[model samples]
Target: MSDIIRIQNLQKAYPGFALEGVTFSVPRGAVVGFIGENGAGKTTAIKCILGLVRPSGGGVEVFGKDAALLTAEERGRIGAVLGENCLPENLTAGQLDRVMRHIFPHWESETFASFLGRFSLPQGKKVADFSRGMHQKLALAVALSHGADVLVLDEPTAGLDPVARDEILELLYDFMQEERRSVLISSHIVTDLEKLCDYIAFIHNGKLLFFEEKDALYERYAVVHAPVEALQGLKDAVVAARRGEFGASALVRRDKLPAGTSAERAGIEEIMLYFIKGERI
Candidate 1:
């Protein structure tokens, strides 16, 4: 499938932080989960993709056109939720609808109202009066109402309760039912991504670590609990390890383990923890 969004060696810099040549893509009809530590450049890379931040080097493309050069109509084709109360604070949902109609050529007021109803957001209340979760839902509702072909969501579910989060995920699932629709989302909630994403893109210390199929990532790594001696034999395959009084637990490549060695399945959270904080072999 073709990419709906592409980042080529994306780079950015600040006083203390730098996004160093991070590269990845969101393929058509796929949900790509962006995962990393808080300071690992995920947001910076996202901002670059949306053309909200100017990169010191590299490039981003959306819909086969340079992100930096996308016309207003082309920009309208992408739906973005930036994880903040970014909507007009003083405007009621109804008023915001009226305003957005003028901004987006394809904006659908009925779709927006349906989403508000589904989300239980009051059309008459000002956005500033909404709770955090309400704010998020409104942002998502607006994004989906614009007839966008792709979604760029940063921490979109941050303040939502389980039921609401599930509702949002369901909506996204419905969105992807159409061919060529895609989503790129980042969240601290790994379990959510595990359920919704086809691919996982990991970044660390300003570098792109790996961008791999989620199932293949799980198949490539396993958690082994064995004696220190057994772990020593698998050092080459161990990505990270921890030693305790009884034994050592390590994240290792499944295919590299010696015959008869048993390894348990590893979740995305466990794998991320191993990469970020686990002791290196």
Candidate 2:
């Protein structure tokens, strides 16, 4: 299957920060989770994909078209929920619906209404009165109601309670039922991404670290808790290690684990922490 979004050597520069040779692809029908710390260029990459910011170098293509040159129809097929709400704060959901209907040729009022009902969002309340979660739901409702083929969401569940976050995630899963729809979601919530994503892309300090199938990532790495002395023989296998008073925990290639060293499956969060904070072996 072709990629719904392809970013190649994408580069962007700010005063003290830069995205360097960042590259990844979101395959059609897959949920590709973008993972990183704050200010790690996740938002910047998303903006470049949506043509909201000009890249300093390299290219982004969405649906076979250059992102910088997307037509109106192409833009309509992509639904994005960035950090900020684009809807007017003074407008009620009812009013926003009318406005969106005029803006998107494929807008479905019934679907929008269903989403609002499902999310328990108030239609008569102005956006300014809505809580952060409510605002997110509204943005998602708008995105889904337009029959978008691809969804680009940055921190869509940020600030939401667990229950509300789960509800929104379920909606995204439902959206993928068609097998052609794709989603690129960036979140600090690794557990949510762990449950929902097929592939994972990790960024750190404005650099692309790894982009791989989530299952493959799990299969490739293991976390081993062993005494510092045990690590002496496994140096070649260790990616990074954190030494403490009691013991040392290291991220190692599963296949290379030395005899007598027990290794366990590492979750995404643990893996990220190892990559970001642990000392490289």
Best by lDDT: 2
For model 2, what is the C-alpha lDDT against the true structure? 0.93
Candidate 1 structure quality by residue, lDDT tens digits, 132-247:
88898899999999989999999998868898789889989989999789999999888999999999999999999899999999999999998877787899889898877887
| lDDT of candidate 2 over 152-234, digit per residue (tens) | 99999998999889989998989999899999999999999999999999999999999999999999999988887777678
| Candidate with maximal TM-score | 2
For every candidate, C-alpha RMSD to the true structure in Å? 1.3, 1.2
Residue 216 lDDT in candidate 1: 100
- Each candidate: what lDDT? 0.91, 0.93
- TM-score for each prediction? 0.96, 0.97
Error of 2 at 11 (Å): 0.2
